[model samples]
Target: MPRFAANLSMLYNEHDFLDRFAAAARDGFKAVEYLFPYAWGAADIARRLADHGLQQVLFNAPPGNWDAGERGIACLPGREAEFRAGFSQALEYAQALGCPRIHVMAGLAPAGADRAMLQKTYESNLAWAADLAAKSGRDVLIEPINTRDIPGFFLNRQDDAHGVITRVGSTNLKVQMDLYHCQIVEGDVAMKIRKWLPTGQVGHIQIAGVPMRHEPDLGELNYAYLFDVIDEVSTQSGWTGWIGCEYRPSRAAQPGATSSGLGWLAQRLQ
Candidate 1:
């Protein structure tokens, strides 16, 4: 069976961020992930996790100046210092929270900049991150976000992510495969899953409705079939990782909308 982790950053918007842990637990989630945990104290979040019996599965390293639209700094030429500091802070939180994975976002590609330079910086940063994370027995993830959702996102294809991981040459480095982005950037998600899952380079997976970024059940892709595919491939490859529910609730205006939209999850578990 595929383990599903509620993406607290996107789901359970009705409740405060800290309270989302309880909401997800009440909805039967055993694990959870989110974009970033910098806003709250790690101890506070840890307390919430303990109270709710939920495990923190994933979260992103700080993206530079989010208010100014800097998605990430890992690929930028002059931001290596900032990136390392941010990642160190993220590691501290991960230790405090007992999370196993941390995602490092590749910043948007600056127009008129050398792509090779950006790739070098990104690989270097990832290499350092992976080395540090390996010492702590944790993994560092790089995701291929779609251009539609995040235009100019340096990493946008599975091949590119895997290629970078190969060059980085660290066992602690892996790809965070978001099926929603995969479907948009490259079709044939099931085939992609089958091809990559067995490689053991895929560290985590995420899902959402294509085109609308809503619940997985309301999308062009049939999640039921995909889940079965995942189950089959996982059984064969022994890939035991959490599938993150990273999508917006269709009924966000209503109370308990996130929980209400989880019928697909219940049906799958049944």
Candidate 2:
């Protein structure tokens, strides 16, 4: 069976950020993930996790000046120092929270920029992150985000993600595969899952309804069938990882809207 982790960042918006942990636990989620945990102290978040008995599965390293619209700085050349400092802070939180994986966003590409130079910088940064994280038995992840959702994102294809992982040459480095983005950027998500899961390089997976970014059952992709595919592939490959429920609630204004939209998850659990 595929383990599901509620993405607290997107779900349970009716509650305060710290309160979302209890909401997810009330919904029977054993694990949780989010965009970032910087706003709250690690000890505070850790207390919530312990109280709720939910494990922290994944979260992003700080993206530079999110208010100013920077997605990430890993692929940018001049921001290496900033990226290192931010990622180091992320590691401290991961250690405190006992989270195994961290996703490092590949920042947007500059217009008419040198693609080769950008890639070199990206690989160098990732290699360093992997090496640093490996000492602590933690994995560093790179994700291929869709251009439609995040235009000019430096990483946007599975092959490109794997290529970078290969060149970086670190076992601690892995890809965070978001099927929603995969469907938008390239069709045939099942085939991609089959091909990549067995490689042992895919560290985590995320899902949402395509086009709308709503519940898994709301859009084009048939998640039930995909879940079965994941089960089958996982059974054969010995791949055990959490599938993050990263989506927006269709009914945003209603109290318990997030929990009410969880019928798909309930059906699957049966």
Candidate 3:
């Protein structure tokens, strides 16, 4: 069975960021992931993970100036310094938290920007990240987020992710396959997983209901069937990676509710 991790950034919104660790453990999650952990000290985050006995499955490298609408800096021109610095900080957190993987987001391309140049910059940055992460025995992941959710985002397709991985040519570099983004950008997700998962390229997988980004049980995607497929892929490929539950709870709108929304995960484990 694939180990499932709660995406604390989206789930367990009823508690403070630091407190979400205990919430996830209380709800029976052995692993947890989040978007960014830069705000809190690494030592504090590490202590929480150790206390809760939760493995840090994944997290994103800092996206530059997120409040100002900058999604990431890896693909942007003239932001190499910012990208490297952000990655250094992320590496520190990953090391402190004992995280094995980090997702490097490709920032949005400028309007009418040179596509080839963007690809080049993206590949170069990924290579750099992969090299640095390899030194610490950690993997670097690149996710192909759909443009619908993140308009103008440079990396927006599986093929694009494949190209970047191929161009970078690093064993430490792998794909972060988020089913929500994949279903929105390119449907036929089961086929995509079967095709991609066995290649030893996928380092991690994330899931949320399509169209709403809610609990997987409410999605158009047949997650139960998809989980079976994931199992088969794991059996065949000997994959031991985590499947991150990166979804918003249906009760997110209802604050202070004592619900976990883990019905899908519970059924799967059964």
lDDT of 1: 0.96
Candidate 2 local lDDT, 1-270, one digit each (tens): 899999999999999999999999999999999999999999999999999999999999999999999999999999999999999999999999999999999999999999999998999999999999999999999999999999899999999999999988899899999999999999899999999999989999999998899999998999999999999999999999999999999998998999999999999888
TM per model? 0.99, 0.99, 0.97
lDDT of each: 0.96, 0.96, 0.90
Expressed as tens digits, the lDDT of each residue in 1-270 for candidate 1 is: 899999999999999999999999998999999999999999999999999999999999999999999899999999999999999999999999999999999999999899999999999999999999998999999999998888889999999999999999999899999999999999999999999999999999999998899999997999999999999999999999999999999999998899999999999878
Tell me how far the alpha carbon of residue 268 in candidate 2 is from the true structure, in angstroms, after superposition. 1.3
Q: Find the number of clashing residue pairs for candidate 3.
A: 0
Evaluated against the true structure, the overall lDDT of model 2 is: 0.96
lDDT of model 2 at position 127: 94
List residue ranges in candidate 2 displaced over 4 A. Answer: none
Tens-place lDDT per residue, model 3, 1-270, is 878898988888889999999988987889999999989999999999999999998999999999999989899888998999999999999999999999998999999999899888888888989999999999999999998889999988898798778878999899999999999999999999999998888999999998999888886999999999999989998888998988877787676432557777778778
Model 1 per-residue lDDT at 170? 99
On TM-score, who's better, 1 or 3?
Answer: 1
Backbone clash count, each prediction separately: 0, 0, 0
